[model samples]
Every structure is written in C-alpha cells, then in structure tokens.
Target chain A: MTNTILVLESVVLVLLTVLVAGLLRSHAEILRRLHALGAGLDPDAPTSELASMPVELRSRVSGSFATAADLDGAGLRDDALHVAVVGTRHRTLLAFLSSGCLTCQTFWTAFGEPARLDLPDDIRVVVVTKDASEESVSALRKLAPPNVSVVMSSTAWSDYSVPGSPYFALVDGGAGRVTGEGTGAHWDQVKNLLRQAADDASDDSREVRIDRELREHGIAPGDPSLYRTAEQIAQESRA
Target chain B: MTTTLAAHGLAIGLPTGWEGRIQRRAVSVAAEQTHAVVHLANFALPEERDDFGGGVTPLMRSADVFVVLFEYGPDAVGKPLFATQGIPRVTADMFGSKRLQRPLPGQLGCQRFFTAHGRPFCLYVVAGSRAYLPRILAEVNGVLTDLDVAP
Candidate 1:
C-alpha cells in the first residue's frame, strides 16, 4: 500500500509540473502580445519591418497658395485710387502697377483682354496704380478693361509690400487675409496663383466638414486615434 | 482639427480625434542659432487613475505624428535643392536628444527637406500603424504644400 501511495504522489508531481509549465508558456504569449501592441503605439519604435515599403512623392503645394497679409488702408473706389480692402463681400485681387514701369505695361496689356485673365466671377479684380499725370492715366485707362475697377493710390505700393511694380495680391475680403501674392511677370503665373488660392479655400472648408463629422462622433481634432481602423491590429502584428 | 503655429508662420491640419500641442526649442548649429517648433499630436486616451499600491506612472508621452519647423533667420537662404548631401540620417539630432528616430520604410516620412521663401524646413511624420501611414502622409503633404513661411 505504501508503494502505491508513493506512485500516486509521483504522478501528482508530474501533473503539477506540466500544468505549471503550460501556465508559464501561456503567460509568456500574453506578454508578447501586449508588447507588440505597446510597440505599435510607440513613435520611437523601429520600423525595420517596413523597410521594403514603397516611397511615394506627393505634391505638397497642390491647390495651395501662400497666405497673404491684411492690406491696411481706407476708402473704396471714388475719385481716389484707394479702395477699402477691409470690409468687402467679394474676394479682391489688388494688382499693383505703375504707369512708369515697363513691366506694368506688360501686365496691363495682359489685363486688357479680360477673357484672357480667366478670373472667376467671384474675384473682383481692382487695379491699384500709383498716382500719375493725366497723360499716364489716359494711357492706363485705354488698357484697363471696362469691367475691372481702377484706383490710384501712392500709399498702395508701401501698404501692399510690393517691392516693385507688376505685383499682385489676392485678398479674401471676408477673412481679411491675403490668399496669394507674387510678381505679375507672367500672366499664367498670376492665374495659377489665383486658382491655387481658390482651391485651397475649398480644401479648407472640406477639412472643416470632416472635423465636424469627427466632433459629432465625440472625436476632437488632434486625436491620434482618429484614423485608427479595426485592421490596424492585424497590420501591427504583421509588422 | 486645425491650428496655426503663428510664431512659425505655419498652419497644420490635425487629424480628427487627435489632440495637439506646440513646443518651441532653441537650437544652434555651428554658432548659428535658430528656433525649432514641434507640433506634437497624440491619441486622446482617457486618463487612467491608479487606485492600487503601484505608483502612478505617467502614460508614455509618445505621439502619432510630429511636425517640426526649423526657423532660420530672414537673411538665411536655403541651400540649393540639388545639395542633398549630408541629409541627417538620424532625426534625433534635429530635435535634439529628446526626440527619437521613428522612420518609415526607406525613411520616407523623415527624409524630405523643404524650403519656403528661402527658409530651409524639414518635416517628420510618424504613424501608429502601417495602415494609417498613407493617409497621414497625404495629409502632411497637404499641410506642407499650404505652409505659409514668413519671409
């Protein structure tokens, strides 16, 4: 009977050892999973697993234009060339030109053909030229399109930060922000800038709409998990 | 969500459900000192209060993405685009020792350098998972494209 009892004790010890080993292995597996998940969230974690991934070059400036500063001055189109840029419903394009500058003549020549300007209806193009003699004004008047507004202001060059003649700036009058600004050396370049600004404005509104959707779902802007997906766990595991 | 780093003359569009903060640090290279602005965004995790004896260890301050803008002097003209030599292999040095190099495959997110109005700038983006990388990159590209650098 003692032998049988000893055998039974040995069997129990073997069984206990196996169970403990199994438990340890299971615990290790759990720890490994936790580690993987933690690493996924770590920005410093090495991404060697992704070394073979393809690199894509995407345009950063597509449909975007440089931000413009607020134009500081007063008054709308009257006898004076200065127009009140601060409060207006339509977007304003301040074309800074001078009657004396040769480059301004080229810009004015381009401006003569309104159809060629290809500006959207919403953009109210205003010619801001330096005060000139009657002769210069008459020359400029012949070049100015009938639909475009023409004004004369000596302060515009300094106020608009136009380093020289043949410069242009697009102002979103509602926001009082410069949407675009550059030298009007090429009419195509000016047109591209305007298109880019309009595209950027639309893109901004789209982003706002997306932000609203996230807010409705109780997610705020800057939430890192905003783009998290159910498949992310699988992707992390593969990595 | 979108916020502007007005001091750096930058505007960034943050992913929805994320939170962001800006920290500015002064850095110097070869006696030329400049400011580096870091826009850090992270997951909006709920606060976990420690109730037991285990000390309250702060959650790791790891972020999903970091947008770093190196501010140069107005007179600083960026090196030509063709001068791609010696682009720092490690990003830790750019932000100082505090940051880490969490590069994507081929260092895609951390590789490129940019210039605006003659000011040199670099961007680094990190994603929690490969699945989110493409979208994050696209968004980052948008921000960089529309970036307004003060001249």
Candidate 2:
C-alpha cells in the first residue's frame, strides 16, 4: 500500500512540474508579443477612407501647417519664406516622422513622390521634424518630394501627439476631431484613402455643375484653401 | 528554479520551458525607445558577393527583416567581433575594408543577432560608452541562445 501511494505521488509531482513549466513559457511568449505590437504591426488598415472626408478638412490636413511656436523659429532662420498655410476649417493629413526612423525612410521612398502626385494641386504635403538644423534640413529636402514643405521644431514632439517615432493622423479640422490615427508607416493604404477622399470631394462637386460657371467667368479654382465653404467652392465653377 | 533562456524554431523559449508559436516571420525591431514595428516584409536579393559587405551585409539568406539594437563589451574595442554564429569569421577582405581602415580613437564595435545566415536580422547597437558593453553582450547572447532555428 505504501509503494502504491508513493508511485501516485511521484506522478502528480511530475505532472505539476510540466504544467508549471508550460505556464512560464507561455507567459514569456506573451511578454514578447506585447513588446512586438501585440502580434505584428498592421500597416494597411486605413487606405479606403480618403474620399469620404470633407474638403475643408481634407485640404487643411494635407496643406502646409505652422504650429504657433514654430512660426517664431522659422522667423529666426535666414530664409523665411512666407509659405502658404491652410486655415483650420476642415480635415487634413498630419504626418509625424523622426530623422532616425529607418522605417520612415523606407516608407517615404516608396510613397513620397507618388503620394504628392495623387493629391489635388492644393493639397500640400507638410512635414514636422523634432529638430531643425541646416544639415538635417538639407537631408530632408533631398528625401522629400518637390511639393513637400518641411518644418523643424523643438515642440513638434509635444504638439503632434507623436507617441512613437513615425505616426500619422487624418484630422477633421472643421470638427477639431481626429478622423483616423495610426502609429506605423502605412503609405499605400494612407495614399489610397486620401486619394479616395479627394475623388469623392471632386465627384460631389461634379454633380452640381459648377465647373462651367467658373470657366464662363474666367476664374480658375486656383486654391482649394481660399474657398470659404464647400458648397461655394463646389458650386462656383458649375454652369 | 533557475531561469535560463532557450529557443524553439524562431521563437525564443522562456526559462520556465513552454512550447512556442513559431510565427515564421521576421519581427520588428527598435533601438532604445519609441520605435514601432510593422509586419510588412521587403527583401532584395544580392546578385554579387561583394554587394552585402560591411555593415550592410545581411546576417541571413531570407529577406525578411526583424530589427533589434545590438550591444557589446568594452573588450571588443578595435576588434571586429562577428555577431552571427553562422559565420564564425567575417574578415575585412569580405568587405571593401576601406570604411574601417582607420579605427576611431575609442573602442569601435558593432552589435547584432541572428536566427539564420540570410533571413531577417534582429536589432543590436553598441553606442555611446563602453560601460554597458558587457551587460549588452550577455543579454544578447542570452537572447540568441534562446532562439531555435528549424531545419
């Protein structure tokens, strides 16, 4: 009877050891996954929403911007061009990137120029970096598209809500709301969505017959930012 | 009782010993802080042997990339320590050898880890001071030992 009891006890101890070992191993895997963005980073989630946004919002999001504090720094620079900035009455695409981010550089290479081409002429591409120096500025100039206007600011880190090295947001400027935000570099999806939104705004305007009227008056809808209202902008050119 | 790291087919095992979920993908990597990893994989094939020389030479054959910051010891100064176990020796001849021709004033070292010779290389960095060198190597070796590459 004693022998039988001893054998049973040994079996329980072995099983417990195995169970505990498995638990710890599983725990370690969980920790690793947490470190790696909870499985893997998804870079293609937001590309389809580009065409559904409001024009004012889209224009502002994609237009050149000046954080209040950065304007002061730009004023201190040698070449202080009075760059055009869109007002905050609509949605815009705000991108935050770091000089040290390799992924940003990679994504930038794939999407930078092509992205600019897809945007309406008025939807300017703007970038805000954490530090602005002559050398860094020069490097950025080489990397970004011709249509891009880059800004260097110490306060960019704080103003951008850039929780990570590279992040992006589609903001509804009129509503003062974030339409969408992502933490990684997903250029294809972002470009597609932005293109779609631009197309939708254009399509919405086409239905109103405004393009012919603008032609008759000999006024081109030169700047998407200058128009006060979406209806007015969409209607002004209609016949 | 003692926690020792182990590897099981691309996934590292905890000291407690559990089965891993071999995702068979290169993980994203970052240095010290605020870097995010995405699951997109892009790999370019090296046509010539000289193409992947120096720091640019990938540690693996597969093109998937996983990033990690590599750290090493103070003793590794002036010497090129091969971080990957697959290639025991990475002589200057393999690369053009022009870049490291004149070693810097202080200890100049490189740090990285690998699962295979031509796959995604993990992140590693040897920056600033030699103070953290020993701790960095130990931590890296520990992580590497835990990784198991399947045949």
The DockQ scores of all candidates, in the order shown, are 0.01, 0.01
Question: What is the docking quality class of candidate 1?
Answer: incorrect
Q: What lDDT tens digits, residue by residue, belong to model 2 across residues A109-225?
A: 654554444655333344556666522665665666443444454454576456764565554444444444454434555666566555655775685567677666775678444
For model 2, residues B1-151, the per-residue Cα lDDT tens digits are: 1122222223342221111111122224643222111110012111111211223233222212212322222233334343354412222122221322233333223423332433334332222224433443444355445544443
Q: Evaluated with TM-score, which candidate comes out highest?
A: 1
The sequence of per-residue lDDT tens digits that candidate 1 reaches over residues A60-148 is: 25534333332222112112112335434557788887666654665777766778778886676777766663227666657676555
Q: How accurate locally is residue B125 in candidate 2, as Cα lDDT from 0 to 100? A: 27
Among all windows of ten consecutive residues in candidate 1 chain A, which has the lowest summed lDDT? A73-82
Scored against the true structure, residue A78 in model 2 reaches a CA lDDT of: 24
C-alpha TM-scores of all predictions:
0.38, 0.29
In the range B13-59, model 1's lDDT, one tens digit per residue, is: 44333332232433346776554443433332111111110111122
Tell me candidate 2's interface RMSD.
25.1
TM-score of chain B of each: 0.52, 0.30
